[model samples]
Target: MKILLIILFFVNASTVNAKTFSVTNLANSATSEDCLDYCVDGVCFWLVCGWGCSVKTTPHINHNLPDFVVSSYNEPGENSFSEVQSLDVMKNIQGGNLTTNSKSKRANSGLKFKEASVTGNPVAYAMGQAKYLCNSKIKPYMPYYLSTLDEKMWRSGLSDMLYLSTWVPGMNEVSSNKNQTDEFLKSWGSLYPRSGFLNQKNEVKTASVIAARALEVVSDGGARIYQSSGCTSADCMKKNGKWQMISPVEENSCRAFGIESVEELKDKVDEDGQYGWTAWRNYGCCIPGPGAFIGSSITGCLN
Candidate 1:
């Protein structure tokens, strides 16, 4: 009893002393990418756990067309940060309601309905998504990335972005909206298994490569945005000279991305050999790239 009590006390003490890091976006002074870069590179992870982040897009959204260029900023003034401490606002942002609702859209003029750029770096894209969650106070357990497919023929998004998972929930209710989420997961394979990206040749795999390939196909093919319903091979991207579109992963596939195998994941799964969502939240990283928010001169901590 004494030993267990001592261990518990030490654990609690460490948690209490854990440092809280924050990323700031100054109004008219920081680019969207700058905000995301801070979140991804700085605050998103402490060792392995993710500290949530978000962005205030109110300053960047404009009545004109979306901005696609990435730029820099100097510094921001006192009252410049667009604070979003409310969970409701965060949900609205994730659900696409903030930018779609007419009244809200007008009130928040800087917002324009669009996706992140498909041409940029996949790692950067992933970082941007992490920044949004980190700023919004969402804790990230598994690392995730975002990519855009910008094919000329596809005007609207076919799919917003592809999310890779580290763990797969097995026959357990992991979300409040389990029905819909499961349906999507059921159709699209629950566990991503792989943790890194795949190279252009797919021989050299890493997290960035995985994101790059997935984003390229989804953005270019426009294959049913954010839907788990099956998509045809027509949505696949051109690999080398041929098209590469993988079918939805099998349910509870529990595969790992990089060198790690399904067996390794099996070893890590809970005692029941099943996994469920624990610290996950309903989050998204999609359209509204920094270009969509950039104005003239910008300033903020891209540190």
Candidate 2:
């Protein structure tokens, strides 16, 4: 696929404050993070410079291009947040793009979820049908082409998770990819702090969204089990299990992923074994319904 990647780098010069050096590309390589060097005493030492900004090589920052929002989408972008007065009503599809249950329900679940997103047997056929003609916006990446036909199908199926979660305001529960890309922007428009991409809300949403879709797409919901990197995975396993938590022992990484209550779920266990403790809110994806527990638990943890 023609995926866009923005790159950034830093160069060394005389270290007087505000001394502007051109910071020209010293090495002739497409990979910006490779070493191009001198040394402490003009001898060659090894420097590894990539997104992590290791010493010895110049720092390189990378960003994805053809940002999703710019593409033509079925849903309308947020227009009147203040005048709408109700987020619930704002998302209503009576005249437009929602269901009555869409307000209370986290998302379409069970077999209905299949039709709620996209449909088809051939992968390319479905992706091509992604309804740019419904509203019709213009972008280079609209019909994003990839090498494998399966990849095209995967992208098509994943479009539901990516498009809906991103385009819809309710789904964008935290600082999104747009915000992430901005915070990371260099002079050439690469994000400054590479770490910003890791704990990013968009990253979590997209990753989880893609994961959810990937599960469904690859296995047609037969492979219900998914392995996630953060809170979502932890919470999924937490629900429906005996769940002997180790307790919040100053979990720094949990907080970093927007997990506000790592400490609370620590001691929390189902004495009655009926109510599974917060599997949704504690998980990576924000289940933005009236109750926070919408996305996490499944069927009351009996098993």
Candidate 3:
């Protein structure tokens, strides 16, 4: 009892200094060629996990388009530090309520989800979604499973999001929606297996990653964004290029141009929203190429 108490006291003392935050199990250096194996049909694992993630995560680079799910589409590039993901905001949804209801198309200016735990399909994004904690308030957030897709898209989003923490950026501290959550998990699990896919429609060979995700909430669907050990093919950059960094969008603009932190780039309503990263190098390296120019004037799009 005495030793146990001593250990507990030290542990508590350390907790007072720093808080533990949960993050996805993805590594830092991810590449594009990683998609070659998973691209398929029905299996939807490709669609469910990889391809779908690609579309939602990458809206600015649509060299190719898919038939179903998400279409490959890249918003025109910008000269700012941040690259915004702005869509046409579809004047209307073809058959769904987006056009009929009028409310979903612009509900809460599309900033809120009325507790999917109660109101959405137990599958899809409605699953793995969560409510987070920021400061003294709690708010909605996608879980690490879903947010894994977020990690793949932007470098510092997880951290930026945690920092901006419009609300505490942690998950489901408490939720009465377990039944729905389980149902949703079952559906998701059927699609994504512990190692290989259980569903015959898909057959995935885990190369360097323990997990994967297709960003559905962002980009309306286009490419698959996932976190893995690194590049798979020798010709990695051949398809997906590295995230290049730039600086100071304008000489004196408050929002410097470059790669906007995920949150800023994700929710921003500008052409070049990628240029607004809150951290220059707080967490890690900013990046190179796309937005890096030590001291060059506006020669073109980024830096």
TM-score of each candidate structure, all chains considered together: 0.17, 0.17, 0.15
Candidate 1 vs candidate 3, lDDT winner:
1
Ranking by TM-score: 1, 2, 3
Runs of candidate 2 exceeding 4 Å displacement: 1-61, 66-141, 145-303
The reply for model 3, stretches above 4 Å from the true place, is: 1-107, 110-275, 280-303
| lDDT for residue 144 in candidate 1, whole number 0-100 | 20
The 0-to-1 C-alpha lDDT of every candidate, in the order given, reads 0.22, 0.20, 0.18
Cα error, candidate 3, residue 300 (Å): 44
Q: Per-residue lDDT for 2 in model 3?
A: 38
Cα deviation at 110, candidate 3, in Å, is: 4.8
State the TM-score for model 1: 0.17
Off by over 4 Å in 1: 1-259, 277-303
